[model samples]
Target: MDHLTALENKSIFIIREAYFRFRNIAMLWSVGKDSTTLLWLVRKAFFGVVPFPVIHIDTTYKFPEMYRFRDEYAKKWGLNLIVGRNEGQVEAGMGPGKGTKLDCCNELKTNALKQIIEKNGFKALLLGIRRDEHGIRAKERVFSPRDENFKWDYENQPAELWDQYKSTAAEDNHFRVHPILHMTELDIWKYMKKENIPLTELYVSKNGKRYRSIGCAPCCSPIDSTASNVDEIIAELESTHTSERAGRAQDKEDAYTMQKLRSLGYM
Candidate 1:
């Protein structure tokens, strides 16, 4: 009945519900603290075995450490790891450096995710997105649906009053289930502490700098922090006034960048 336990139990219920409601489902593993925590919740829900695939939409621009952490955990946890990429775009010189942040994200990250989901016929995808992470994400539902074109009708999304959720989606598209949507950034770190979750050193400070949010290396900057461990991070978060994604470059591209991206089916 405590705070952390309550969060865990709800997340477990959501994970299991998504699994049973959509048998052809997968979870996104961003190799970040949030998504990694989602992976932990999956194991807890299914009793040590993740019954579905876990996806990493590799833009081919991520930090080398991220890739190493991904591979290590995928094997250590025995995950069916599916690496998603838009090889053609990558080859055609589509990237944050060559184009606008929105364009780059759509081509490399959003389109890549869309292609993989369609190719694999995933009826539902469990994302570790939390509302507290971004302003646009605050508009998300526990069970959000997309059209065949991978477009989200954010304005007309089905309401989820109380615990009721609209899990139904069209035959040609899928649902994006947010199991950890209700959890906050601090909640994630606290859960990590309680669960003894392992994190990549990228989150830990080295030379008074640590990444608060990680994406492709080119777009992710480090914050000034000396919080080298989970306990220190939790303590820092208590007194810090920084946004969780202050290091992400994409959000700074435009005031409505994230909203537009989500509308276009970006995760």
Candidate 2:
């Protein structure tokens, strides 16, 4: 099989394995390219029907277009979309401008996710994170486990050789399944194009700028690009030297900012 096909096969197998191993499970959908592509993969894996609920941590500071697209598509596709928000923090004037990037992320994104996982009692969370996205993500395992406190032990993850993954974890601990960890940004675009997946229009370049990676509106910035279509995005990635997360202000605040946030249970 070709590389793309191979990746799809591996991801399908991993999804099925996670389904069998975990009694309570859910997948996180950020409504970005990666997660949208992962949503398509879920349909493919389950024969056009997703078995589990898709979780989205709504910081309430997301781009208006993102929510519009999300609501439209969720209804169009008949998705089991579950939105989680930290009402207390949002009500108390918590936002990117009020706190540091790490603090804002922890309060709005990570803590919200943690509460959702706990409320739903999900034993596994399938994420669409890729290793190439950042340095910290590069150290993730296919079936990585996070403690009740949401600490990721990058140094002591389980082994997964020859397609055999370890899905077991202790009580109250959730396994993070990253099926597309090995895929490059180009592969994701190509797959999305081939599969005819719907995506947020904000990704398409407008006035010589397009968002390479999306997050909270205040923190995420657009990169200089003229690529308006999926094929053009693939071509741009092939020639671009800048990292995908470069436009993300949070990652630029400090060298180890992401690492620190992630260690403290930020996604």
Candidate 3:
């Protein structure tokens, strides 16, 4: 098999494994390229239909296009879309406007995720996170565990040698299954192009800039790029020296910001 096909097959296998292992599992869809690619893999793995619900943590600060693309695709694909949010926090003026980026993310994203997981009684969460995206995410296992409090015990991570993933989690702890953890940013763009996946228009160039990694609108910025389409994005990624999340403000807040966030159960 070719390199891309191999990656696709591996991800598909992981998805199927997670589906059969956890009775109440859901996939987190951020509506970004990586997560969207994961969504495609779900359809492929389940014969053109996604069996589990797709969760979206709405921070209420997302770009307008994100919501549009999300609504459009959920209907187009007939997805079991479940929107998660920290409604109390959002009502109390909790956002990037009132505090540090770290605080905003902790409340808006991490806490929101925790709330949904508990409320929905989800035993496992399928994430599209890749080790290549950020330094902290690199420490993740294929089947990572988080306590009921949503704290990630990175130091005591379970080993997964030779595809033998430890799917079992302790009582009150849920697993964070990362099927695409081995895939890179370039791999995602290339696969999207190869599969002709419908992506958010925000990734394409507007004027002389384009979003390399998308998040909440206030904290995310576009990089200087002329890549207007999937093929151009793949070409640009080949020679680009920039970090994928270079435009993300939360990661720049402090050196251990992401580590701390993930430890506190941040996605």
Candidate 4:
């Protein structure tokens, strides 16, 4: 099999395993290319139907196009969409502009996700995190554990060799299953093009700029790119030395910001 096919098969297997092993599970959908590809993989795993709820952590700061795409695809794809939000913080005018980016993210994203998981009693969460995205994420295992507080213990992690992933966690702890932990940025674009996957228009270039990585409008900036289509995007990614998250402000605020955020359960 080709590389993309191999990645797809591995992801499908991991998704199936998570479904079979966990009693209560959900998939986090950030409405980005990586997560959307993960959703497609879930469909392929379950024979064209996703078997679990698709969760989105809505911070109310996301781009309007993201909200539109989320709702439109939820309807079109027949997804079991569950939207979670830190409504209290949003109502209090707490945002990236009003506070530190780390504080904003912890409140709007991490805390919101914690509340949803606790309320819904989700024992396992299938996230669309790729190891190649960031230095912090590169340390993640295929099946990572989170405490009841939703904190990731980076100091200790389980081993996964020969596709033998350890899914066991304490009764109170939850597992974060990374289905596409192995896919690179280039692989994602290529997969989307090959599969004809639908994506938010924000990814395509507008006036010679495009969002390589989608996030809240307040903290995310568009990169300089003319790659409006998938083919051009793949080519650009092949030659660019820039990080995938160069547009995200929080990551740039501190050298250890991403690590701190992930440890605090910032997904």
Clashes of each: 0, 0, 0, 0
How close is every model to the real structure, measured as TM-score?
Answer: 0.92, 0.92, 0.92, 0.93
RMSD of each: 5.8, 5.4, 5.8, 5.7
lDDT (Cα, 0-100) at 207 in candidate 1: 100
Query: How much does candidate 3 score in TM-score?
Result: 0.92
lDDT of 4 by residue, 1-267 (tens): 999999999999999989999958999999999999999999999888877899999999899999999999999889999999988998999898887888999999999999999899998999999999888999999899999888899989988889888888789999999999999999999999999999999999999999999988887889999998999899999999988888884455665886789899996
Model 1 vs. true fold: TM? 0.92
lDDT of 2 by residue, 137-213 (tens): 98899899999999999999888788789877788788999988888898899888888899998899999999999
Query: Candidate 3 lDDT, tens digit per residue, 199-222?
Result: 899999999899999989988889
- The true-versus-predicted C-alpha distance at residue 42 of model 4, in Å, is 0.4
Q: Ten residues in a row with the worst lDDT in model 2?
A: 249-258
**Which residue pairs in candidate 3 collide?**
none
**Which 10 residues in a row give candidate 4 its minimum summed lDDT?**
249-258
Worst 10 residues of 1 by lDDT: 246-255
At residue 41, candidate 1 shows an lDDT of 95
Model 1 whole-model lDDT (C-alpha atoms): 0.91
lDDT values of the candidates?
0.91, 0.89, 0.91, 0.91
The local distance difference test score of model 4 is 0.91
lDDT of 1 by residue, 72-132 (tens): 9899999999999999999999988887877998999889998988788999999999999
